[model samples]
Target: MLMAGCAHFAGRHPLLGYTEKDHPQADTALVVCAEQEQYICGITGVNQVATWEKFNGGKTPWVRVLPGKQVIKLTLSNSHQLNRQQVTIDDVQAGHVYRIDVGFNATLLTASYTDLGKMDAYTIHMPRFPLSPKAITASF
Candidate 1:
């Protein structure tokens, strides 16, 4: 039953990469969510983001964003509970790649990013709490 539900969701939202018809412009930056084994991390939204079909193509997890400041909404799950977070990039530059890593340690959730341009990293720690099943479902 679980597999069937996942298949249904995947059919509705197929992952794709950048293509000529749906590729990012030269003046935009790319942001990707780093997959971790201890937790599940995903990019739920981007700034003024349309559907996930626009930025992600070719089966990639990265999304394109305009230069300057951008806000990315993310969801982190550890099977039992789910948490939502927003990470802001103050100076996103064009033609550069950025990666956001979500980590779970005890009751804390940490989000970090490294700008590929400077290779500098920053981390944001958020308190994690268990949510009721109804609350988790409502997040969708």
Candidate 2:
């Protein structure tokens, strides 16, 4: 899994991706992964409503997010179509993997979320139609 962080540390690389050896004491950890070949995508974060990490080529990006209502969307690199998913992050404990995958059904896009640490699973169907300009703008 590929990862990125906000603040930089001295002599530390701006980018880092690796498994956490120790227990990470936090509210929640979100791992957004997409397997669309030849397509680049990204997941939106809460602050400033911007895309956090770009899923380029063959890497999965992860970040730590607060436990609350979070709107996650995958923006295609070369298309206007956005596969969106709304997740209510509640009862998520640290040291667990909450994985979300963006996939397609025929031509329509979809999302499947699973907590590997538990028995929870969820599937969401993205919007059939492209979002209107006003509908998209109000979100930011």
Candidate 3:
């Protein structure tokens, strides 16, 4: 598995396929699967859909995609179950960063997105699954 620590150093080489080496930061949009405690989330596929051999079992936290409408596949998991969810973001702007947030809302496993680049923050609800309270609580 590939692991990326939250650190950076001068002259350090970038991770091939994981860094912005190929996808320039100024023209590509980034989808970040922020680490969470309530559940585990990972980016599985970006538009142009590559093979699972590069998925690293969803351990990679972020992916770069061309600006415009893009479909992202993700793996979401809690203590009781695992699921794959596909989210479509329309009119994705270049040089902007978007984040996928997954959480349990007492009744369902919820996913949403936020445009971090904007000041007027808003959340777009994505796929959701009905999971019982017992199942969610068991994780604790």
Best by TM-score: 3
Ranking by TM-score: 3, 1, 2
The alpha-carbon lDDT assigned to residue 27 of candidate 3 equals 68
* Native-to-model Cα distance after best TM-score fit, residue 53 in candidate 2, in Å: 5.2
Going through the candidates in order, what is the number of backbone clashes in each? 6, 0, 0
Q: Clashing residue pairs, candidate 2?
A: none
Q: RMSD to native for every prediction?
A: 11.3, 13.6, 11.3
Clashing pairs in 3: none
Q: Which residue window of length 10 is worst by lDDT in model 3?
A: 131-140
lDDT of 2 by residue, 51-110 (tens): 443423222234444444444444443243555454544555444455666665667556
In model 1, the Cα lDDT at residue 73 comes to 72
Q: Pick the candidate with the highest lDDT.
A: 3
Q: What TM-scores do the predictions have?
A: 0.58, 0.44, 0.62
* Candidate 2 total steric clashes: 0
- After best superposition, candidate 3 residue 118: deviation in angstroms? 6.8
Task: For model 2, give the 10-residue run with minimal summed lDDT.
Answer: 131-140
